[model samples]
Target: MNQNKLQSLMLCLLFYSNVSVYPVTPETIHIIISEDKTMLSEWEIPEELTLDTLESKIGTHDRTNETEDSIKYIWDHLGIVAKFSKNSKFLNKLTVFYATTLKNEEPKQNFKGKMNFFSSDPNQKVEATYKGWICRFKLGNRSLYGICKGENRNLEQIDILSK
Candidate 1:
């Protein structure tokens, strides 16, 4: 009886302490970029891929949506969203998001100097490791509104534009 009561007390204390008992595992995607920061690629993926050929490299997307002008191919578990032109079918840009709290996403950054189109500079921070959070170095050609968008945030997503 005493042991049962002790265990129950311990469980109640832990639950009331506001401690997270379960940690979320993040989804990840890996990309290889060109030296000029204009092209994007991967292990088996080509430098430039169209909507029709994207699946041949990275496999089929989890879900997709389209507009008259553009199409989006999303891989939820892999944390990738490739956007392309509807007429040309050529890839316009791809986004990588990792923060799962807001949308249950995970990210893995494994770029070296001159490898990936870093945040305009190779010394910039790109991904949040399992140890802690990280910020995207530079913002792409997107609307910043008043402040720098995607700056100093936990790498929610990024647009890798094509040439």
Candidate 2:
């Protein structure tokens, strides 16, 4: 993605909403890091998202796949794939695809959301304008990382997964 556009996206992510982590009726979607920088969340998808609560928040999935150790719920229109351990109900991974169309075409109407990452502690600051920095934080009781992958200069996906 273009540098200017990436910066713009980060800005929107950080300041689009100021509500607490679990917003009841969100006006704008967002993922926010805790004030201390050790925790991160996209509460719309929440740390506790599971098989039981999935449909209520995201509606029905378009597809589902289960393997020996995991299950995946895919929403094609929303470009999200939520994963869970076979024996667990909570999300083990969440994938958000961004480059949904062909090259030179307009960006698809993706998850119109924002993200905010900040730290008040001088020793723990993270850059929101990172070129390829790993965004690391805690997701519930697990350590997690959010990574952005690209192809042909287009942002392809953001994967938030256990570390």
Candidate 3:
């Protein structure tokens, strides 16, 4: 694909709420990751989104693609890392990472947190922290805590993975 078209597809993958990842929810987009496919997280894309709009909203950053099939976008200050696979006229196979500190840790955090399951407690809240990411959700009185690392290094040219 051309440069303009590539950028457009990246924007669509990063900020399209109508797009579904797992076909479970129409409004919420969820992604699963990990060696065993045990981690999952929710993401929200902007309603009015475009390449220019994303840059303005998240500020300038770096983009790297060693080949036509894959690309990675990084916004260090904004704590965002996005990876995409290009197969169709429009790119898909999207993965996004937003950097965040876990609880009281200092900023610029990078670590994969552990997943915890707790029994239902009506008066208590669920809590979890992984690496630098934290996920807290409630199902009735049950609580789930999950975390996944979302940072990546840019690949050099001639890399097989990018190829």
Candidate 4:
């Protein structure tokens, strides 16, 4: 082959190799919150947990029932996590950590916090910001805030924009 053609071929190969590839193997992270008698849980790790898993494990209903909204929210967020990991690196890291923690810890009672959405693209960076006694545990500069109040209120909220 001509030298110019050979050089062009090598350049093409180099370009292809340099393209970023996301991690395919699913990594799971779990987070648990409990206060008094109330307990809240979230799983974000494992990029493989699909919409089906979320729907089945947490019920695939809209937030209509005051009694079941919390559970429905959890599954909805899980679906969001699956979608988010497809694009954002920071979100993947956060979900992985969150899921792992929840998977390991035993359920508890009386914990209050909010899960806030964060993003770290090629543009901006953020650190955990807390209000009052609330402690923010950030992952990849992004977060999904949740808060459990006393033994009666167990809230789990997920930020849809994390991805």
Global local distance difference test of model 4: 0.32
lDDT of 1: 0.48
> 1 or 2, which is superior by lDDT?
2
Clashes of 2: 5
lDDT of 3 by residue, 1-163 (tens): 6999999998998766433322232123233322222222332333223344344433444444445665455443323344445543322222232335432221233223222233334555434334354444443433334344445322111000111
Q: Each candidate's TM vs. the true structure? A: 0.47, 0.50, 0.29, 0.24
lDDT tens digits by residue: candidate 1, 36-85: 34332434455567766665544566667777887777766455677778
Quick one: best lDDT, which candidate? 2
lDDT of 4 by residue, 48-101 (tens): 444444444334422221222111122222322223233322222112112222
Number of the predicted model whose TM-score against the real structure is largest: 2
RMSD of each: 14.1, 14.2, 15.4, 15.1
Each prediction's whole-model lDDT (CA): 0.48, 0.53, 0.35, 0.32
Sort the candidates on lDDT, descending order: 2, 1, 3, 4
**Sorted on TM-score, highest at the top, how do the candidates line up?**
2, 1, 3, 4
Candidate 1 lands at a TM-score of: 0.47
State how far residue 157 of model 4 sits from its true place (Å): 4.4
lDDT of 2: 0.53
Residue 110, candidate 3: Cα error in Å is 5.5
